[model samples]
Target: MSSAYPTAIPDPAEESAPTTRCRILAVAERSFREIGYQKTTVADIAKTLKMSPANVYRFFESKKAINEAVVERVTGEIEALIAGIADAPGRTAEARLREAVAALHRDTTGRWAGYPRIHEMIEAAMGESWEVCRQHVDRIGAVFERIVRDGVRTGEFEAADPAVAARCIQAAITRHTHPLLVSQTHPELEPSLVELVDFLLRSLRPAREPARG
Candidate 1:
């Protein structure tokens, strides 16, 4: 997998050049959410930001660049949350993994829903940005891999392959984040986010000793 940075941060000097760029980003994010990616345009963002299209273009070269920025921003938030859960003290690997999954679901499905369009756009792009998305997922997978490795080393888990287990954990994590997958199969149950977390943790745990039957 590529190790390059996904989004380049503008110069520090540009940071202090008023809040026009920041305002443009905020407005663009909202416009994307309300109108979907296909309908959202630079003009829409500029009008929302109370700036001319040319001025908006001054900050971002194209709508694609802005979309990349939006996706990068949201992906960073998701990565930070996963990292926090992984680093939390007093939690076993199993518990930490569950917490990480739950936190991801809550953040993605609740507070960060506005950025779903950003993800949709990235998926449709399926080029350079797709690599960025993969790297983002791999970052989360690295956390899961560490948890699995720690579990096996400490005898908390009996998995023979930490990498395989990590991939499974990543699958579970993705399932929780993708509402369509959850809704399509079990429309009736509609499991709470916490319930899904418990389900995933239980699946990852080693089997109990066989009954004496």
Candidate 2:
């Protein structure tokens, strides 16, 4: 697949700078998906795009830069998805939290699980493009925090610290959400997604008061 949204090959004279850049990233991301990022070279991307390597570098200084853009595009999408769920009106915080966690697991498994080599793309982002990965994590964490704060406000959850609780929620779902671990680990080795989400929700609920005399 050339891209999730493929465009026709660009004519240098006709395509705007942003259009050319998007074209390069589209080809580069396809190559990374099919061939793995370590082996997908600038020349290969340029060749596939019918452009010179020099032209490819006009937008991205290095393969790493192109990969960063691709990872950002992917993460930006999931972030928006989670953010929308976090802010959806007329939903309880617990409901939103469950949906958001399930969405992350579903998105991760759908995109990376059972795809043997695609982990290379995320591995590259985690190693060489860590700021991009870290920013994505932080954004996701912020969404969790928003939900936690809502739950606290509504007296549905008790947390001495919502930020800490949010990070805990993110950490708790790593097995379900982290691409590398999800791709590599067998399903039986870990708790089921529903089981895990239910456990997390239980941890977030308010502590019950003991019966008085």
Taking all chains together, each candidate's TM-score versus the true structure is 0.77, 0.88
lDDT of 1 by residue, 74-147 (tens): 77888898998888877898788777777777776664354545554645445646666777878888988888
Candidate 1 wrongly placed segments (more than 4 Å): 1-18, 111-122, 125-128, 179-213
lDDT of 2 by residue, 22-106 (tens): 7888888778877888899999999988989998888899999999999898899899999999999999998999999999988
Most TM-score-accurate candidate: 2
Cα-based lDDT for every prediction: 0.70, 0.87
Candidate 2 colliding pairs, count: 0
- Which regions in candidate 2 have their CA more than 4 angstroms from the true location? 1-15, 209-213
lDDT of 1 at 81: 85
Q: List the residue pairs that clash in candidate 1.
A: none
What RMSD does each model have against the real structure?
6.0, 5.4
Best by lDDT: 2
